[model samples]
Target: MSAEIMPYVVAGAMAGGFINGLAGFGTALFALGFFLVVLPPFQAVAMLVVLSVITGLQGLWIVRAAIRQNTRRLARFLLPGLAGIPIGVMILSVIDASTLKIVVASMLLLYGGYFTLRARLPRFERATPFWDMLVGFLGGILGGAASLSGALPMMWCTLRPWPKQETRAVLQPFNVAVLAVTTILLALKGAYTRETLIYLAIAIPAALLAAQIGITVFKRLSDTAFRRLLILMTFVSGLVLMLRAVL
Candidate 1:
């Protein structure tokens, strides 16, 4: 990466790490918007996958206790997500990158809009394994395609009758597993180059530092406040994704 481009990349990493730290998701949405400005789509997605793993690890540590207690429940969501990943990886190899970005952006916009109007919308009942697996499958496809596996699960958790901590417990680990798979697939595809390593050297530290700051902010917010913030950020992320595609 050029010296001039490094700053934007670091800024994006920090912003992404912060959001992921706070809400346990959205690292790609927040980071890729800035990265897409300076990097090609493949390179940017590769970098975000690496950073997503870093952020996911950090987030897991923050919520370790909840994860331990709910491991069984989480497995219901993760197993099918694992099954769906290879299909998503195949899509990534074959699909037009620009078209994928537009599709992802449109999904984000619709997801955000739905949540913004959630109060007016009818409430969903408790989550069933069928729905969990369905969303997890979709999330895996998106994750493999664009490092966006978390969005659907995040939105799903909000609609379900879960508390904030439980929501984090499930999605954080799920993201870690999916992104870990993404990284391996990218490596198999030889997406990582010398430049990618250099970018990671810069990104990892920025991401870790910002994640801590976000965790601090998350600790301070009430459950109600956190949910509202999550909704707003989702909407903002969608707008950013769409703008990146157009401009």
Candidate 2:
């Protein structure tokens, strides 16, 4: 990457990390929205995969106890997610760059719009195992393709009657596992070039610092406030992604 581009990369990483810390997801949506502006789709996805693992670890640590208590629910989402990653990766390998960008950007726009009007949206009467698996599978595919595995699950979790912490417990660990798999697959596929490593080195510290700030803020927020902030961020992320795709 060029010297001029380093600032954008760092900014994206920090923004993504902060959002992930605050909301327990949206790392890819926010990070990739900025990254695709300065890098190719593959490289941008690769970078976010690595950084997402770091942020995921942070989130998991914050919600470790809750995760242990809800192991069964987590598994319902995770087991299917594991099955879906390779399929998404395979699609990523074959798809053209422009098409990939459009698909990812469109997903962001659609999901973002959904979240923005989520309060007015009807709620699910009950959670089903089938819906959990489907959401996880779709999330895994998106994760493998563009490091966006959390969006679907996050949206699904919101519809349920769970509190904010419980929602984080389910989504954060699932995101960690999916992102870990995606990172490993990318490494095996030789997606991480020397430039990617260089970018990672520069971006990690900024991401960590920003995430800490977000985590601090997150603790003070009520469930209702958190949901509102999440929807607003989702909408903003979608707008940014759409702009990147069009321009």
Candidate 3:
């Protein structure tokens, strides 16, 4: 990349890493904005996923206890999630960046609006294996296409009766695992380029540093406040996505 672009990417990586480390998911959203301006949207998402794996690995380690406790639930969603990854990639290969921007932007807006209005919303009545599989499948597809799949199944977990920690733990590993597969597929499909690797090297550390800061913040935060923050960020991210699409 050019010198001027390099700085923007590094700044984006730092912002993405810090937000994700603090919030557990905003990395891709932030990266999306930065990369879309610097690269194609699909390429931006693919590169972001690679950087996310590096950052997410740190998150997984910090939440190891939570992961262990929710292994079974995560495992339940793995197969379907894995199965759907290629579908997302296939879609990405065919669709132009403009279409992806519009579709993802619209989805984020609708999802954010709904969640913001009803932070305490319930899950689908039939959140059984069938629904889980279907959701996982769709999430994987979207993930492959846009790297925004992290929010979908997580929304399902949020409405469950479990304690917040348990819910978060259950989703973390699954999100990481799904992203891992999606990243690999994207790389194989030619999303991984020399510039992408260079960006990853710089961005991954930013993610780790930000994650540590987040851990500190998380330790200080109350659960109710954290929930409110999550809702607020989701809404903000939706607006950002919409703007990216339209502008």
Candidate 4:
């Protein structure tokens, strides 16, 4: 890579890492933009999955106890999400990814905008294993098709009043699992060449350090604030998503 490209790589790593550490998801969504500027689409995505999973391990550790305590709940989201991945991959053959991203981003914008204007956050206190699974399944499909696995879950989890750690436990591991599968598939196709490994070496440390900073900020937020942060992120992410698709 040229020296001109180095800044964008570092910027993407830091951006993706910080978001992953703070929110337990969205590394690819935030990082991919910077990467796509200088890297091929396939190479950007290949590196993204790796960076996402590697940095996401820190998030998993942050909520390790909550994860253990809520394994069953996590499964409700994860197993379905995993099942949907191949289908999502299949969808890519028949559908236009930019169109899908635009549609979803529009929904996110509206959802985040409408809720932000309301005084109270929407709360769903009832146990809804069915809904959780559905969200996870759809999220997986999106992840597979558009590398957007976290979007649906991020929307759904904000409706619940789970503590920050508990929410991270779900979002963090779900993303890691989905992206891990992607990483494997990409590896099988030989996406990781020597050049890619060189970029990974440059990216991993930048991401790890940035993520640690995001974790510090995450630890300081109250439950309500954290939920609000997710809500705000949904809006920002949607805007960014739309721009990426359109541009």
Q: Per-residue lDDT for 185 in model 2? A: 74
Question: Which whole-number lDDT from 0 to 100 does residue 46 have in model 3?
Answer: 74
Scored against the true structure, residue 119 in model 1 reaches a CA lDDT of: 69
lDDT by residue for model 4 over 1-247, one digit each (tens)? Answer: 7999999999999999998888887888789889988999999989999999999999899899999999999999999999999999999999999999999999899888877777899888999999999999999999889888989999999999999889888999999999999999999999999999999999999999999999999999999999998898899889988897898
State residue 8's C-alpha deviation in candidate 1, in Å.
1.7
Q: Compute each candidate's TM-score over C-alphas.
A: 0.86, 0.82, 0.80, 0.96
| Most TM-score-accurate candidate | 4
Candidate 1 local lDDT, 24-61, one digit each (tens)? 87788778778988989899888887888888788889
The Cα error of candidate 2 at residue 245, in Å, is: 4.2
Model 1 gets an lDDT of: 0.81
Q: Report clash pairs, candidate 3.
A: none
Residue-by-residue lDDT tens digits, candidate 2, 58-100? 8888888888888888898999898888888788888764566
Clashing pairs in 4: none
Q: Scored by CA lDDT, what does every candidate get? A: 0.81, 0.79, 0.69, 0.93
Model 2 per-residue lDDT at 80: 89
Q: Which scores better on TM-score, 3 or 4?
A: 4
**Candidate 4 RMSD computed on C-alpha atoms after optimal superposition onto the true structure:** 1.1
lDDT of 1 at 139: 82
Kindly report the root-mean-square deviation of model 2 from the true structure over all alpha carbons.
Answer: 3.1
**Ranking of models by TM-score:** 4, 1, 2, 3
